[model samples]
Target: MIIEKCNICPHACGGTRYEDKTEGSLCALPALPKILKSHLSKNIEPGLIGSKGSGQIVFAGTVLNDSECSVFDSESDNKKSRINGKKLAQMFLTLQKQGAANINLINPTAFAHLIMEALREQPLQIPVVYSSHGFDSLETLKQLDGLIDIYVPFYKYHHTQIAQKFAEAPDYPAKAQIALLEMYRQVGGLASNYKKGIEQGLLIRHRVFPDFSRESIAALHWLSHYLPEGTGLSLLTGNPYLAWGEEAKNKQPLKREFERVKTALQDLQMNVGYIQDRETGEFFYLDEI
Candidate 1:
């Protein structure tokens, strides 16, 4: 299953990735995995971080190449972080040994082929989670059917113009909708263990923008109507620093805005994950329904 012409992501840049040394892809990366870090973290979804913490593998590149992403801006030399699939498999084993609740793959869309190879080399004991940016191709996600146990993806935007304005991905909303539907079809609904947090299912996260509450509401409504009854939802307060360009510059949501969105989500009466306080780094979860 070597990728000769890379269609692993939505970009489908058609690079010769199997040739090892070639790097003509839009992500400017090879088929090899490039990891920034792999460690236990409690900063992720509350349901994912059990007693031992979620095993987070933050990959180096993104197909979207979002300018606001700190990882993309900070790393000057990505080649230094490159590792073979076998080594990535070893990292997974190490995390499992360290009592990680689940194997969380962050920003893995660009390296989907490489990750599949790694999983093949070393089958995971714990659930394999695909935490992505939501700009994914259905064909690529179909390849991960049996391999991925949980899908933690963002429903970033409901409006096509907003997606195109920020991420230069005009088709993001449509692609994300189809991809999420596929993810739900694969995993069904949320399943958890008392000791092991979330074991399997689709957990959708929507980051609330300062003046874009309508979009947020639209996303929530869509999830409520379309997804399964037990599907998990996380409403994250947007970070001003993570915003890019004049449209989002120095923008922060007012306290009242947060309250309004929170109240609307509570009204949904679904399984809410957590409402993060962007300023204080605190997490607030809704009482069990």
Candidate 2:
């Protein structure tokens, strides 16, 4: 299906994105993808990082207005560098040659059309990881059924008020729920190659907000109901760097809050990928927890 007006994301802003140099869209992107950076990184999920790290491609821009977004803090100008589908395919091939476990596409929802084109030009040998903000549309995800392998989506919020306040997307919670379900439907449950540290399945990452313990617990409960018994969950300690200029109310999570979230997750008895210590910033896995 041809996307004349960009409905790639859930926003459906209807901006004219067929032209190569078009602007005035929600993501401020052109038809071709603007590559921010591409590298093999060990900082990703422990399971995805084999002896050779996962090949990561950080795409420019976002559809959400997250107050605690780190992309803006790190990059001064995201629209400066650009690459077409063919070049992107070559980059994917290059990473595979260098022994990358999988090709991880960061913030790819905005450039989903171009990414699909790239894959068509050079079909990937390794698994394709779609690392997203969990605000994807079901139609777009259905189009990506056979292409994607691992779905690492960040389920940021379960409360509508919190989602609207921080992300300017009031319907985020509902959309995230449906999007995650579609992802699981496509990829099934978590399957791991422990010896190689390679995984092919759904790994949901949820960050515990400072004063949102209830919301965090609610999100966990929803996951427990819908997702498989041993779904991989990464409960991250919210990044202090992302909340730098935000309100004092939205600062780092408190010790008690962390304990509450940890206790709530423990009660669920799901597969906890990693949990960060509130004080020491240390990470513990399911067995350790």
lDDT of 1 by residue, 78-141 (tens): 4565678888999999999999989999988878877888899999889899999888899999
User: Model 2: per-residue lDDT, tens digit, 195-235?
Assistant: 24546778898888687788889999999888876567878
TM-score of each: 0.90, 0.91
Off by over 4 Å in 2: 1-3, 18-20, 70-79, 192-196, 248-250, 279-282
Name the lDDT value of residue 71 in candidate 1.
49
Local accuracy by lDDT, each model: 0.78, 0.78
Taking all chains together, the TM-score of candidate 2 against the true structure is: 0.91
Worst 10 residues of 2 by lDDT: 72-81
TM-score of 1: 0.90
RMSD of 2: 2.6
